[model samples]
Target: MPKFAANLSMMFNEVPFPQRFAAAAAAGFKGVEFLFPYDHTPAEVAGWLRENQLENALFNMPPGDWAAGERGIAALPGREEEFRAGVARAIEYAQALGTKRLHMMAGLVPAGADADSYRATYLANLRFAARECGLHGISVLLEPINGRDMPGYFLQTQAQAHALREECGEPNVKVQMDFYHAQIMEGDLAMKFKRWFSDIGHVQIASVPARNEPDDGEVNYPYLFRLLDEQGYDGWIGCEYRPRGRTEDGLAWLAAYNQ
Candidate 1:
């Protein structure tokens, strides 16, 4: 079975952030991932991880002022300085948390802008972040989120993510394969998963369309998990899904998979 990581940002909402680490541990998750760790001091989060005996599977680089509708700044024009600064800050936190992966969210393309301009800016920013992250033994990932979730958001397909990574010319840059996003944007999940398996560094899962628990929707996660095992994918699979009820109640699928 693929190793599993609890997504603290989306899961375990019944408890506070700090307490979620212990909650995940109690629920049998050996690793964890989250959105941003800016508010909590690195030392504080490190302490929690140590206490819970969980590996920091993954976390995203800052995406600018999230409250102001900025999904990410990497693809935004004239934000190179802010983007690089965010990369540096994320590195500091990653080092402290012993995390080896960071996802970079490509921001939305402005209404009047074209794909060429956004791609150029995104590639440059990814290269810079990839180099910085590479120095810390971390892989920089670019996730292709679906337009339904965030319309106009740059980078919305596996092919586009691969193209950007190649254009970035940074060996450390890789793809964060979120199955839920892929299912939303395209069908034939298993075929695409196999096709792009090599380029993927980290993985996330949720149900299709609704983004709920994996088993509740169209995606057949068990077969995919078996395929991953057959292929020897030794990375963390983040349970990046929302619960239909209590978070703990939704973990039956995890137990079934482990068996």
Candidate 2:
């Protein structure tokens, strides 16, 4: 069965960030994930997890200036120092939170930027991140966001992500296969899952086009869930979607699988 983790960033918005941990647990989630936890102390976040008994499945390495719209800095040429610092900061939090996986966002590619240079920078930064994270038993993740949702984002396809992972040649660097982006860019979710089963480190899901709960989407999640079980995928499937209504009201689809 698919082990679902609520994305506290998108779900349980009725309360503040700190309270979402309990909200997710009360809703029967065994695990949880979020975009960034830089605003709070690691001890604070850790306390919530320990209190709720929810496993911290995943979280992204600090994306540069999120409010300023810098999705990530990993692919930016001159920001290598800042990117490395972010990696160290992320490791501190991961160690405190006992999180094993961290997603390294590829920054938005500036217009007129040299594609080759950006690719080189991204690859180098990824190798550095993998080495640093490996020392602490943490895995670094690379995700491909669709152009429609995140224009100019560096990584965009399963092939591209896998290729980069191979080029990095680091055992701990893996791909974060988000179905929301995958369905938007490539519709063959099952085939992609099977083809890259060995390289995937994490999974995320949301309805296509609407980015809502997976129950009423173009993608048949039930079929894919069965496929995951058949293939013996023992990883957290993050519910990284916005609810159409209240978050709790949209959990009927998850109730059957929560057990």
Candidate 3:
């Protein structure tokens, strides 16, 4: 069966972190992913995970204004120092949590920023972060957000994310394939899954249209789950979506596959 990880940020909003961890474990999920656990010390977060016996599937590196229009310039000429510091902080937390994967937020490319310069800067930062993560046996993943959902984001396409991973040439750096965004930006979901499976380090999903429960929207998640199982994809498919009602109310959809 495809292991499911509740996205605590979305699922258990209003619940304290420790409670969220325990709730996910009680719900029969073996793993959980949070948006940013840095607010809590790594040791504290690690202790919670151990208490619940859950794995930390994925967590974001500091977004650093990517949510505003600042677009991450990890490769920006003047921001190299800031990027390095961010990576170091992330590594520290990932180590404490015993997480194997860290998602690098590639900020949007600035207006009039030379593509070559941005690319070079991004590649440089990625290489540096990859080395740090490699030392801890952690893999760094770059996620491409949809321009529709996150306009002006730097990495928006799987092809672009794939190319960046190739250019960085770091074995520890790979792509995070988010099905909701991919369904919007690129169709032929299964084909993309097949083509990019080799480079995809992690996966996340919510149903299309409403971005609610998997059964409440257009995607055929049962088939998708079956595809992942058949292909032997052994990564967590994170439940990253907005709850249409109470979070637990929508969890029944997972029963289809959880059984």
- Report the C-alpha lDDT of model 1 over 1-259, residue by residue, as the tens digit: 7889999999999999999999999999999999998989999999999999999999989999999999999998889999989999999999999999999988988787877877888888888888888888999998999999899999898988888788788888889989999888977877877888888999899998788888877888898999899888999999999998899998888997565
Which 10 residues in a row give candidate 1 its minimum summed lDDT? 250-259
Clashing pairs for predicted structure model 1, backbone only: none
Question: Of 2 and 3, which scores higher on lDDT?
Answer: 2
By lDDT, the best candidate is 2
How well is each residue in 111-186 modelled by candidate 3, as lDDT tens digits? 7879888788888889999999999999999888888877777788899989989988889998998889888887
Q: What residue pairs clash in candidate 2, if any at all?
A: none
Off by over 4 Å in 3: 66-71
- lDDT by residue (tens digit), candidate 2, 1-259: 8899999999999999999999999999999999999999999999999999999999999999999999999999999999999999999999999999999999999789899999999999999999999999999999999999999999999999999999999999999999999999988999999999988999999999899999986999999999999989999999999999999999999988976
Residue 117 lDDT in candidate 2: 99
What's the lDDT for candidate 1?
A: 0.90
Highest TM-score scorer: 2
- lDDT (CA) per prediction: 0.90, 0.95, 0.85
RMSD of each: 1.0, 0.6, 1.6
Evaluate model 3: give its TM-score: 0.95
